[model samples]
Every structure is written in C-alpha cells, then in structure tokens.
Target: MVLRNIMIGIIIIVLVGGIICWTLFSKELREGKNLPLTGVDFKRLADGTYTGTYEGGRFKWRANEVQVTVSSGKVARIALLKSTEGRPSEFTNELYDKVIRSQSLQVDTISGATITSKAYLKAVEDALLKAQK
Candidate 1:
C-alpha cells in the first residue's frame, strides 16, 4: 500500500510539472494571436527587392523571412527565403498571391493557421518597409 501511494505521488508530481513547463514555454505562442500587423503603401515604396524577417516573436517559434520584389511601384513577387518550419504549406501560395493581388497585408488570414499567416505577412511587411521612400 505504501509503494502504491508513492508511485501515485510521483505520477502526480510529474503531471503537474509537465503542465507548468508547457504553460511557460507556450506563453509566447498563446499570445501570438494578439500580434499586430500593418500594411505599407505600395505607391510610397521604391522599386527594389527587399528582404525582411519576423524574428519569430520573442521566442522565435515561427521566425520567417521573405524577399519582396517591387516594380513600377507595385508588388511583383514575393519569395519565401526562410521558414522556421521547412517547406511552405498549402496556404503559403494563396497567402502570397493575395498580398500580390491586393497589394496589402490586410487580407483575411488562413483559418487554422492564423498565427502562421500573420508571421508571413509580418515578414512581407518588414521587406516592404525597407522599400518605403
């Protein structure tokens, strides 16, 4: 009976410790939804290719980088330079296309990937900022 009680106590301690660690480690990710994103004016951007990065929030969980090409004062193309996660997913192209088509970072974020979408857009915005005149 004493052995069983000790085992149960150990298990409870492990579970509680895991929960505490998870909460602390994931705090930044949890707060990512509140990340603010702003769009730059295309008319004000000089014609050039600019590279920008989102340092992946405070902890760099989703850090990303992109190259933005502006020609004739409009976004011509955007290429992913680096991603925290290898390989762009299904939503990547759609998000980039939307930015190019609309020329803005105010597009609707991809469902179930809202934080990721914001991170990419933030990187694009960073690139655009460099081109701002």
Candidate 2:
C-alpha cells in the first residue's frame, strides 16, 4: 500500500511539472510568432517622435512603453519608458543602441537576455510602425 502511494505521488508530480512546462512553452511559441519585424522602411516615416508599447510574456516580462525619435528619415534615439524583467535596465538600454546603430529591428538579441531583448525590440517595432507614413 505504501509503495502504491509513492507511485501515485510521483505520477502526480510528473503530471504537474509537465503541465507547467507546457504552459510556458506554448506561451513562448505564441510570442515567437510576433517576433519578426519586417518591411519597415525608415525613409517612408515622417520625422517626429512616436511611442509604442509591447506587453508580452506573463505581464512580468513586458516592455510597457517605448519612445522613438526620428529625424530626417533616420532613427535618432530610442527610450524605454517602462519595463519589467529580471535583467538590469542597462541590458534593455543596449537594445536601444542596437536599434539606433542598425536602424533596423533585425539586429541580434542580447546574449543571456532573450526575453528582455524581444520585449525591447517589440516596443521599438511598435514605435516604428506608428511612424510609417
């Protein structure tokens, strides 16, 4: 009887772990669909400031808002107004620099900070989308 109980407990634990893993995995997969930012033409955007927000992940790993500045058809600056994540704010700031330097969202994400990187990129993409035309 005791062995049976132990087996049942082990099974319950495995099932619970599997459910948790599946939940996180599916969420990441859904978010991945939105990762690609393409066909953004800087030249087509008007020179001005724009704002955007990407509330991704489980609300705890989100970039609430980002401000982008465009001048003379170039991305001049990017600022993160709000974000919630495990990494330091400086890591997020690196994303802004990458966007400004590359003038595109195709730049690589920061190593060891994939979620924050994606959130920051998404926020920038949102801002650029607003700048279109």
Tens digit of per-residue lDDT, candidate 2, span 1-133: 9999999999999999999999998888678566767788765778899998877656446546889899977888888787664468788789778877776544345455456777888988997999993
What does candidate 2 score on TM? 0.57
Give the per-residue lDDT digits (tens) of candidate 1, residues 81-113: 889856556677788898788775544444554
Task: Give the worst 10-residue stretch by lDDT in candidate 1.
Answer: 105-114
Q: Please, what's the RMSD in Å of model 1?
A: 13.2
Question: In model 1, what are the clashing residue pairs, if there are any?
Answer: none
Candidate 1 whole-model C-alpha lDDT, 0 to 1: 0.80
Error of 1 at 78 (Å): 0.3
Sequence-dependent TM-score of model 1 = 0.60
RMSD of each: 13.2, 13.7
